[model samples]
Target chain A: VPGDSLSYPEDLCPPDNFNMVSTWIYRSSFPKKKNFSFLKKLGLKSILTLILEDYPDQNMKFLKENNVTLFQFGIAGNKEPFVQIPDDKISAALAVLLDRRNHPILIHCNKGKHRTGCLIGCLRKLQQWSHTSIFDEYRRFSHPKSRSMDQQFIELFDGREAWKVIDPKWI
Target chain B: VPGDSLSYPEDLCPPDNFNMVSTWIYRSSFPKKKNFSFLKKLGLKSILTLILEDYPDQNMKFLKENNVTLFQFGIAGNKEPFVQIPDDKISAALAVLLDRRNHPILIHCNKGKHRTGCLIGCLRKLQQWSHTSIFDEYRRFSHPKSRSMDQQFIELFDGREAWKVIDPKWI
Candidate 1:
């Protein structure tokens, strides 16, 4: 029943990434236990969190109870000069995502705006998508406020280096 | 350049109807003159105004200058037992929409909530879409408050009778 395809409840704010290349990969804001019923429909086996803050115990317990794995990756800071996203963590998260066992994964942050956006921006780079398209997708979701630093970071990211570290066969 | 296709500005809330069968049929809230540049991108030939209150002079003047036709169809009141939407006006509006010449049309009320939503609900019925799907679309856009009368109105509408009055070659 948990894995059955059903309409996502309105409260969940379910993932609807415009550039999702696979149904197995999802991007969303931080999900609560109330969202679990609807999220269960995604059949997610892993969660890649980029909170850069304290992880709630309830969420950790929920994931364990649901038999889902947790992969926490956070970048310290809010804006540029303050923001500090390490390449190694992103590569590690990508490695987790690449593992076939972690199919149907969700990536999330506080509001799924900046940090999550950067990770997705890097993923788009790895997929060989154009810069214009990547920035468009990022800005569309993060409208009213898009950080130029995130754009700059994405543009400068060496996805080849990340892939080299992760050694993902799919890419 | 006024009619040329351009990227819709992020500030202007562009039309995003869930049940749009044709790119020509656009639905949105009342637009300010500032929205004209972005709205122009739609290449709209006409606007269907359903505001119960007086239509602003600026909007009318803007429409005239842009060479776009206006079809004002207002329904009185807010909730049930008060709101009175005339059947004939709906017939007329449908007639206007049926004319391919008046395509790339936009339908709007104050917030594009009740009246515009009702018309869309009725259109969904004419298109033979499911009630569940119709309500889902309505509630998604009109979240926090969705009236039952609107749903009832759409459910009871005789599309055949409306079609009989407007009998265009298009479905």
Candidate 2:
């Protein structure tokens, strides 16, 4: 059960089927959300994002109009600059969003599933939430059809001792 | 006819047996002797290199000695950062190897092939060398192990409108 504090974006409507989950997240494992019509519908006017190459142009126009500050960081998985960002950058994203009173941030991948879920999942983990709580938050909102998108990340959690710090919900 | 300035790295073994010329380069391309061992002999007391990933301890000790710098910078084919080195950083490496100029400066990737050759070739182009001389430089040094490699690079040359700007032998 999600606490009253848990919030979901009002615009994340079911796209007639669960398969839509795959369409949004595909290219890379960083937070590169695109197609902001949903954000516009939900009245989200500002955002910050990190994305890989060929980010959606429509989203660029959206970010520009919304006056959001998009910080593009490149990641080549298992390659140079391979070191993941410190927790500080993570905190920074949330701090700006929260200070502005949760201006409806949209963290996403091309599919808006794995990496997006990962970031959100980690936030829940930090807050000591239960697996039920985090999944509930996910189910309550986006209702991802594709569950296996995070297979590698889940495997990493087991291998890297990241589970020790993973939010309780993931356990 | 090869020029008097014809020089190539000794121990010019390609990373693999398949790394011959022509098949991997363009029909218009020429290659000279350059190989991986050239890097080991650079005599850096400290070097951060990723090449050690492929070689076992019996083969390499620079890593254990903490004498290699292996940060990612070059472009990965799939827009990933497999081995990334920014342009400015390579210039830095060039500076370290040369003062007024007498030092062995060798660079290579698998095969002494495409990527390595391309960058070196760019140095020649910068010198405003003629395409005739440039192609001559490549042919004199490498026999094009496979016609396809030569075609690969020659294709790149054929397409470049400003051929002189990217010749690969001047340096």
Q: Rate the local accuracy (lDDT) of all candidates.
A: 0.67, 0.34
Regions more than 4 Å wrong, model 1: A1-171, B1-21
lDDT: worst 10-residue window of model 1 chain B: B1-10
RMSD of each: 11.7, 24.5
Isolated chain B TM-score per model: 0.84, 0.38
TM-score of 2: 0.29
State the interface C-alpha RMSD of candidate 1.
14.2
Which tens-of-lDDT digit does each residue in A14-81 have in candidate 1?
Answer: 33321232347777678876567656766779988887677799887878878888888877634868
The DockQ scores of all candidates, in the order shown, are 0.03, 0.01
Which one wins on DockQ?
Answer: 1
Candidate 2 wrong stretches, greater than 4 Å = A1-38, A54-56, A71-88, A135-171, B1-171
